[model samples]
Structures are given as structure tokens and as C-alpha cells.
Target: MRLWAASVAICMAQAAHACETALLLTIDVSNSIDVAEYRLQVDGLADALLDAEITDVIVQGQSALAVVQWSGVDRQELSIPWTQLRSRTDVQTFAAQARAMPRAFVLSDTAPAEALDFALRQFADAPACDRRVIDVSGDGTPNSGSDPRPMVRAAERAGVTVNGIAIESMGLAITNFYRREIITRDGFVITARQHRDYPRAIREKLLRELSRILG
Candidate 1:
């Protein structure tokens, strides 16, 4: 009985280590976002994770995820630590944590460059996985900090894919900027027609990111 238990524990430990992807979700909490908008972003993310298709992919792939709330140069908080989604319970727990998480910043400028830099550093502590991705969602382009192009290049060189979700509340300016300067060569961008459409866009993005067929 003792030998059987030991064997099972070893197999479980090995399975836990076999993650297919490490995904870091970076959300913008700049001053441009009103309180209502912030709530939408937060709730939308939680809802996206709960979507049936998204949850299915997460469980099947054993994807590890983390969330960062980013704004100004000095404002980037790890809202949720890395959590592996290997089962229904794990997905439910992650969604609950995301829904309950508080906003990290309220009155800061948009600084995509600094946010990207901070996100890159996060991968150092990520679990071993087949892919590393940073999914940055923002409603504005960079208004402060260094240029993000170089950092985007650096991320690509480090074998990390940086994708983007552009909230088009202010028009396509942010979306164009993300396409040209933010997303990596192999990464794709999702466009939210407005802040209200964030949940749908996030669901699609998560599905693509977590699915083996699309990934």
C-alpha cells in the first residue's frame, strides 16, 4: 500500500509539471479607464476564463496563467499569481480569484513600454512550459516610458510571444499602434470594438491562445 501511494504521488507530480503554456495577462488600469470600465475589464476577464470553450482548452493543455494590472512606469501589480488550470476545480478557483481581485491602479498614465518590460521579468518565475506568452490588453497607446519596439524585440529573442488586445473605445489608433509596435512576429492581436465587447474578445483570444489547433 505504501509503495502504491508513492508511485501515484510521483506520477501526479510529473503530470503537474507538464504544462503546455505559461500565459501572462497584462491589463491596463490607466487613468483613462473610468471605474465602470475597470470593473468591466476585471469581470470580463473572469467571465472569459469561465467560458466553456476556454475552460476546456485550459484544462486539456494544463496552461499556467497569471494576471498583472499595469499603468504608469511604476504601476504594475501582479493581481494573480501563476496558477495551473489542470481541472474544473482549478478553473473555477482562478475565475473566483479574478472576479474578487481589486484594481491595482486608478490614476496613472499609459506606459506600454514599462508594462512590457515588467511582464518580461515575470516569465523568469513561470513554470516550465512548451510556450511562453504575454497577452497585453489596453485602451491606449504609450504616453510615457521608453520605446516598446526594442523591448518587443527583446521578448521575441527570449522565445516569448507578446500578443495584444486593443480596446477601441478611443478608435483604431491604439489598435494600429499595437500592430506596429507591440505584438510579436508570431503573435496576433484581438480588437475589442469597445470596452463593452471586451468579454467576447477575451473569450476568442483565450480560446486561440489555449487551443492546440490554433496555438
Candidate 2:
């Protein structure tokens, strides 16, 4: 009887920790991203998390989040560890942490395939959630490492969705590349007119991801 009671408690604990979504945000910080552009990406993401609608969804759904900075084949860092947004305070704390984080890599080449591979490993450590998503934000296509399409397929096989946010500083070329090679079939892409517009794009993307609204 004691063993059965302990088993029930363990299951209850697991249920309580489950979240609506586990989102892994992978940002590019390759050589092309200047210091100012890097700041924009980091600060923009911080501000997006503070958006009213986004905050509300996060708090209500208790979504898990992590941020990764990726560049060349071996340059990928988990800037923000797995955190659960279960309340207003939790959201605020995450925003503050994001804003204060230092750039993980610079002077590195673009490697989207390696980035995706790294992000997939991150999911293994995340809290259990109903949906798992990888949000890749970058301004350029891969110029180094393996092809990203296979990684996208691997994500699909893992039942993980891969979304893209293309920073269109160099025009729609990068956006087109993302649509063709990065995002999964069930996922979509958001285009930021430039680095400065990342905050708005990220907010909208978060809304759609958390709410499951394709539009």
C-alpha cells in the first residue's frame, strides 16, 4: 500500500510540472551580426517577453523556455537555461535575465544545421510539455557545416516543430532560404524587416506559438 501511494505521488508531481509548450529560442550571432545588431536581438527578445498578451499566455499556460546563441559548427551556447513561466514574477525574471545576458559568440560563421542539431539536444533537458518548438532567428543562410534540411526532418521525427524568424536586413533572400530549408511543414516563418523590428516580430511569433494561432 505504501509503494502504491508513493507511485501516485510521483505521478502527481510529474503532472504538476508539465507545461503547455517548451520553446527553445536559437539566435544567430555570427560574424555578420555587428555589436549593435546583437544588442538589438537580445534586447528585442527581452522586450517581447514583456508584451502583455505574451506574458498573459505564458503565465496561464506555464510554458517552458530556453535561449541559445549559435554561430559556427562548434559555437553554440545555451544563454538562458530552462525556465518555467508560471506567473508574472517568473516572466519578469526571465525578461531581466535575457536582457542582461552577454553575447555568446562573435566573429563566427553561419551554421544553421549545427544550430538545429544543438537545439534538438536541448529538448532532452527541458520540462515535459504538450508541444515542443525550436524558434530559429537569423539574418543569413548557412555558409558552413552540414545542410539544415536533414536537421529539420529530424525535428519532425522527434515530434518537434521548427519555426523561423528571418531578419531581413539583407532583403528577403534570408527569409526565402528559411522557408525552403529551416521551418518544418507544420511550422511557419516570421520576417523582421530588420534587426530593429525583431521585438515586434518576436512578440507576434510568441503569440501564435503560445496560442496555436497560425495567423
Candidate 3:
């Protein structure tokens, strides 16, 4: 009877923790991003995850989150591992860890292709969720490594969505580049006029994505 009771408890726990969405957030740490800009990006993401609405959705939806820092080829690091947000404390703890994460790469080129490829491979280790989304935020087009178009196609083929946040300083050049080559057909892009606008842009992006998960 005890063994049967343990089996039932394990099944109940698994049902309670089923993952709804696996979200992988990628940050650019190439040479273009100055120290201040990097801080703004990381802190902004931390704050966005802590927003009441975003936090509620993440916890309620049983979302699993991870963060990857990427720059030049072979310079992507999973700064935060996949964490299941089962409660407000879980979300808050993850946000705090995000804010405290150190830079993974510096003085490197912008290699979106490598970054996207790296982000895609990470999903293999993430929790099994109904939706797999990669949120990649960058300021410039790829200047090093292979083309990113292939990785975008790969994401689409794998049924994973690759959204982009373009930090544009010169008009819509970066935004247009992302639209043309980065995100998948089911993915979208949000444009931040400059590094200072990162906080607002990331908050809006998170809300949009999490709300869609709720729907």
C-alpha cells in the first residue's frame, strides 16, 4: 500500500508541474553594447519578469524560463538554467538572479547566426512544454559567423518560434534587418529606439508573449 501511495503522489506531482511554455531569452554582449547598455538590458529584463501581470502569468501558466548570453561565434553561455516558475517566489528569485548575472562575453562581434543556433540547441534540455519560444534581443546585424537565415528556418522547422527585439539607433535599419532575416513566420519583432528604451521594450515584449501563452 505504501508503494502504491508513493506512485500516486509522484504522478500527482508530475501533473501539477506540467510545463506550459519554455521561454529562452537571449541577450547581446558584443562590443557594440557599452557597459551601461548591458546593465540596462539585464536589469530591464529582471524588472519585467517581476511585473505583477507578467509574474502572475508566468506562475499560473507553469512557464519554464532560461537566459542565454551571446556574442561572437562559440561565445554563447546559458547564464540561467531552465527554471520552473511555480509561485511568485520562484519568479522573484529568477528575476533577482537575472539582475545579478555577469556578462558572458565582451569585445566580440555580433553573431546572430551563432546565437540563434545556440539558442535553438538549448531547447533540447528544457522542460517539455506546449510552446517553445526564443526571445533574442540585439542592436545590430550579424557582422561575424554564418548567416542567421538558416537558423531562423531551422527554428520554424522545429516548431519553435524565434522572436526578436531590435535595438535600433539609426532609424529602422536594425528593425528591418531582423524582420528580413531573424524571426520565424509565427514570431514578431519589437523595436527599441535606443538602449535607454530597453526597459519599456522588454516589458512590453514579455507581456505580449506571456499573454499569448495564457490565451
lDDT of 3 by residue, 160-187 (tens): 9988899999899999998999989988
lDDT measured at residue 5 in model 2 versus the true structure, 0 to 100: 100
Q: Order the candidate numbers by TM-score, best to worst.
A: 3, 2, 1
In model 2, which regions exceed 4 Å deviation?
1-17
Each candidate structure's TM-score, on Cα atoms with residue i matched to residue i, is 0.92, 0.92, 0.93
Candidate 2: give the clashing pairs. none
Scored by lDDT, model 3 comes in at 0.92
Residue 162 of model 2, lDDT score: 93
Candidate that beats the other on lDDT, 2 or 3, i.e. the better one: 3
**C-alpha RMSD (angstroms) for model 2:** 2.7
* Per-residue C-alpha lDDT of model 2 across residues 57-172, encoded as one tens digit per residue: 99878899999999999999999999998898999999999999999887899999999999999998999899999999999978899999999999999999999899997669
* Candidate 3 lowest-lDDT run of ten: 206-215
On TM-score, who's better, 2 or 3?
Answer: 3
| Better candidate by lDDT, 1 or 3 | 3
Model 1 alpha-carbon drift over 4 Å, by segment: 1-17, 213-215
Best by lDDT: 3
Q: Give me the displacement of residue 193 in model 1, in angstroms.
A: 0.9
Decoy 1 TM-score against native = 0.92
- lDDT of residue 6 for candidate 1: 100
Displacement of the residue 150 alpha carbon in candidate 2, Å: 0.5
